[model samples]
Target: MPRLRANDIEQDKIARFERIKKAITALEKQQKQILKQGDLAPEGAWVARYQVSQNRKKYWYYKLQVPTPSLPCATSSKLSKYKHLGKAGTQEHIDAVMSVFRRSVWDEIQRIIHTLDDCLLDISSGSEQEEEEAQD
Candidate 1:
């Protein structure tokens, strides 16, 4: 069997770490949006999609469309509709939902990080042993 170089293993581990970090950041942003606007409002926000092409490479991006009152003239109807908007439910309910979503994502990230840590430790230990054998 061929022995793996320490640098090679470390580079792979670092790349995995960076990818996990990016996922965590994205999740956190989603969680914040839910918390700030209340679950229903943000859920109803329209999604705008666009594609950009540069140097033969294409990338897609999405942004939330701001919601405006559909019945601008019906002041009473508008008030009644949005009356339950922020006051639809208790803060506890919103927090509970966000908590569940955040926890599940966080747990997955933690599991991946733990697995990568073990792999890094094993690689370091193996490299140390190899160095000792080379010296002997």
Candidate 2:
């Protein structure tokens, strides 16, 4: 009977390491994007969609929507509707919020990636051990 080959296990470990590295790089890239969001407003704003009748023609209009827990934002209005941005300002509101959203996303991803560091190190050490054993 043939003994099990370490090469197969080494390859598998190498593949896993490569995957982890890719994930780390991707997370770094995402964090960079968040950093590039420029200055962010302290107030959190959102746009809500509603139907309006314009000369008997129906059209959708957007306004700064109410803040939700998901966004966790601050607004200029303590407890009032947002009209400071004005009508047709949905795009502006969303753009303003991207910084906050990106920051949260980046933070969450980094937190998750931090937990994988130990696993990465273990994989690396195991791979080296397997390679050395195979060479013997």
Candidate 3:
């Protein structure tokens, strides 16, 4: 097996750091566009539900992606935090769907950016440590 040299390792780290920085910049731009599109809409998912009772009723609701804090004495399930959108064919319903989609896309972009940021930090710190060792 061929052993890797210290110079080869340093080059690899620099390459990785550059790639991560590029990815983070792209993700930040996408996030900004998504935010601009969703500026007027509240972030949540549009949900449709059915009931066995009341003549098999169908309902539409908007459930927040992140649940809000509840009162100390409140005995509510996570599922109970939905806000009724009422009637799925309305313009409001369409807007709600768009809002949900925008929020989901934004969240995914943010997640990628965060993970890349961590990797970039790790690579930066590793390079710094190597430099210090080389100076000793």
Candidate 4:
């Protein structure tokens, strides 16, 4: 077996780095596709609670705990804290759940893209350092 020279190893690393870059580009395209899927209201959290009616019939209700936008010199008030989404199994409830699920998927894709970017940076920097040492 022939011994691999430092230059040859560096070139191989560069090739792999380019491949990763292409993969990241593809992920970005998919991210855009996700945005175009449906309504992406990625704000607030869905809340579910059980309540008893006057006749002691227990039922579940869903609400969205939307955070009020902060303003300058705003007082601590409980205004527009939660918006009712009707009872469970309703269209509003189902839509809310699906919105949350889509947001989670979007977040995961962002995390993956960031990790790949970091890896590319690490590999490029290592290669630069190696080249500097080889010149000395």
Give me the candidate number with maximum TM-score. Answer: 4
Which 10 consecutive residues of model 3 have the lowest summed lDDT? 65-74
What's the residue-level lDDT of 64 in candidate 1? 32
Rank all candidate structures by their TM-score, best first, as comma-separated numbers. 4, 3, 2, 1
TM-score for predicted model 1 compared with the true structure: 0.31
Compute the lDDT for candidate 2.
0.63
Our tally of clashes for model 2 stands at 3
For every candidate, C-alpha RMSD to the true structure in Å = 16.6, 8.9, 7.6, 6.1
Q: lDDT values of the candidates?
A: 0.50, 0.63, 0.65, 0.72
RMSD of 1: 16.6
What candidate 1 gets wrong by more than 4 Å, as runs, is 1-89, 127-136
lDDT of 1 at 29: 70
For model 2, the stretches where C-alpha displacement exceeds 4 angstroms are 1-4, 39-98, 127-136
lDDT string for model 1 (14-100, tens) is 676676567656666765665565343332334345577899998665433335543123345342212121222456435434544
Better of 1 and 4 by lDDT: 4
Off by over 4 Å in 3: 1-4, 40-46, 50-66, 69-82, 127-136
TM-score of candidate 2 relative to the true fold:
0.46
lDDT of 3 by residue, 1-136 (tens): 8988999988999898998899889899988888788542344444454333356765444333225432122344544445545465666566666777887788889889888888888887874455444563
lDDT for model 3, please: 0.65
Per-candidate clashes come to 0, 3, 0, 0
Error of 2 at 92 (Å): 11
Per-residue lDDT, model 1, residue 61, is 51
lDDT of 1: 0.50
